[model samples]
Target: MSHQRRRGQAAIVYPTKVYTDSRGSRVETADMDNPIPVTAVFVPQRSSRAEVAGQQDIDVTRMIVSADVQGIDSWSRVFWNGSMWDVVVPPAYHHGTRHTRHYTMDIRRRPS
Candidate 1:
């Protein structure tokens, strides 16, 4: 399966806490206790797709994976190449089988 050939390991982040600080402020943080190891290919968004998006300021990168990766949603974040990519939309799942499931993610690069 393509998942077996995955070379990059991605960290999946989820919110785990929200608390008030001593100075009467609220702080929200994410939890990164585990990483989802999957093979992924990163590619530049095609002009056709970009034009359809109709947003010129932000850049989009498409990530492809073949595995039944769990615990990810639009609210989740993916860490790769020393940068974080926000899940542009909910992950699209396809090609279901007894042991493998394919996932496609369209992620937007976050400002550094």
Candidate 2:
């Protein structure tokens, strides 16, 4: 691990399984039992109020984890700080010096 200070442990949740219906449709179900744990650093990137049909506050956060952390993609959701964050973008690999290599990704959450 790098010298970066980690905020805390974060849980990465992935769909447990995909079920095909009789009509040939696929459905994904959450895997509540298993969650991938990783040490991550969370940085609040920005917060903005989005006005659509209704006003909602959107928070964008940047999470950094070791390169060894795997199985996380845009389809994954992160549970941190008592809330769930949707992975907004694909994980970006930063191949720095051997010790500094890590993955950074942007996650978004809408305040309820």
Candidate 3:
């Protein structure tokens, strides 16, 4: 099966086309019945900072995972509710000038 790609959206996983021998008439259709839009989460920053970026997408499960900060200082995790994406946890709170920082990411799956 190859992926069906569309501009500005997620590339859907599609099954190989089926050719029938019915009077040489060819028809195309999706294998799946109800196709909900799927998207790939692209986090520009490092994994640590991706959490921040994910907070912006509409879905959470398909997030682009990676570390952002140099020493695991900050990061982001997105939450998807099948329809909306919300930052379960904002960026870790790091002191501006303090050697030690308070990093906390409250990202978790919503009881499904």
Listed per candidate, the RMSD to the true structure in angstroms reads 5.9, 3.2, 18.6
Clash list (residue pairs), candidate 1:
6-39
TM-score top scorer = 2
lDDT of 3 by residue, 24-65 (tens): 877543334332333333332322222564353232332321
**Candidate 2 segments whose C-alpha is farther than 4 A from its true place:** 5-22, 26-30, 49-53
Q: Residue pairs in steric clash, candidate 2?
A: none
lDDT of 3 at 110: 32
Against the unseen true structure, what C-alpha lDDT does each candidate score? 0.64, 0.75, 0.32
Give per-candidate clash totals.
1, 0, 13
lDDT of 2 by residue, 68-94 (tens): 866677767778878888888889999
Candidates ranked, most accurate by lDDT first: 2, 1, 3
How many collisions between residues are there in candidate 2? 0
Model 3 residue runs over 4 Å out of place are 1-87, 96-98, 110-112
Q: For model 3, give the 10-residue run with minimal summed lDDT.
A: 65-74
Better model by TM-score, 1 or 2? 2
lDDT digits (tens) for residues 1-95 of candidate 1? 55443654554444234568899898654346656655576777843223554545476877776555666667667787778777777778877
